[model samples]
Target: MRRKSVVDTLREIRLLSELDDGEIAVVEKNCRWKTYGASEQIIDQHSDSNDIFFVVSGRVRVVNYSLLGREITFDDLEPGGHFGELAAIDGLPRSASVMALEEARIASLPSDQFQRMILSHPKIALKLMKHLAYLVRTSTLRIMDLSTLGANNRVHADLLSLARKVTKDDMTAVIQPIPVHSDVASRVSTTRETVARVMSDLARKGIVERQKDALVVKDLERLEDMVEDVRGE
Candidate 1:
């Protein structure tokens, strides 16, 4: 693959799209670029560094580990997504660690430069504010689920969430390259065994099917009802 130029990579980020060609060039010139191998740690939770990073290639996961050594996954960023802006804006330590899910290229702008850019571009600053608001809303919902839902219900909710994201037509949804059971467990803050058991029951009920490389939700409505029943929604 041809390595993308820093300017081209910056242009790929939606957050920076408001900048014109010349402005993107300026931003690119100030960026520090690096690459990480699969599963490599990109940032440590509570680290003092506050540089904002853009995903130029590949994917990464935003995560943190509990004192008991269990992983909690917050979100995954594919090409064009960015992270670390909260620390940049607040001048605080990182709230979560990030790890590369695959070999990835990342370009970072120091906090000072990031601050200057956003302050100078009102549109960029407004977009960032909106983005942070979305993050807060999502965190609130996840916290509510953790506090109120049982492990089984959380797992069902997680599956339903994924199914909705990729649902096709009215009856079926396919999570291609089926998610790893352990990974799903981490997202829902449950044990791998629980996830596996829930999946097995769903499969037996013909609500879901396992293909050679994907998990097919055969009855999306049934899965939604399962989650709604627990939530009383």
Candidate 2:
């Protein structure tokens, strides 16, 4: 239900929210859309790959594992979110793995291609750097939370992140659809059972509504309050 152009796509992500008209034009000219099957490995962990991809449709799970075989989720990327950005910019190997959560369509722009597009646009590079810094800080906070918080706190944080992307008013949040419940569990560092219970509780309280496969959050203030209480740790 969203526009497929780079401008509309950038509007959905915080990083490119501030891009100017000229910068947007450059991105539109360079991005190329591609499709992937469900369960495909979009990017392998520790792989020396260098293309940044935007999810235009479908979902991706950014996951990594610990020495003890625990899978930690860095994020569940939906439409309008991007991955491989840090590696593409810094020439580093990918730090995490990305798998398609469903049949997906992605727009990928490789590092060399990105550099060619922005060759004369030094300001765009600076803007992107600033954006990546924010992601690092955000990821660190989630890591810290997972180390210290319980299931409730983790779920609360996840909801807050979802809330930020959802175009909503006082009573309805239209979040992009996400399948693969295990992906959510990984990001929260909890079991899927816990997420299910919490969601059931929210549904009972009329704070959320199931829209076929996706959720429509109906009470933003309560969701925020729950996260605030957890953060009070």
In candidate 1, which residue pairs get closer than 3 Å at backbone N, Cα or C atoms, i.e. clash?
A: none
Q: Tell me model 1's lDDT, rounded to 2 decimals.
A: 0.91
> For every model shown, what is its TM-score relative to the native structure?
0.95, 0.68
Per-structure clash totals for the candidates: 0, 0
Q: Which ten residues in a row have the lowest lDDT in candidate 1?
A: 1-10
Off by over 4 Å in 2: 1-34, 54-58, 67-70, 78-81, 105-110, 116-119, 171-180, 203-219
User: For model 2, how many clashes?
Assistant: 0
lDDT of 2 by residue, 18-82 (tens): 56767666675677766788989889987887988888778998888888878887777888678
Residue 13 in model 1: shift from native, Å? 0.5
lDDT of 1 by residue, 150-216 (tens): 9989998999889888987868999988979999999999999999999999999999999999999
lDDT, residue 137, candidate 2? 93
Give the Cα error of residue 37 in candidate 1, in Å.
0.7
Judged by lDDT, which candidate is best? 1
Candidate 2 at 43: error in angstroms?
1.3
Off by over 4 Å in 1: 1-8
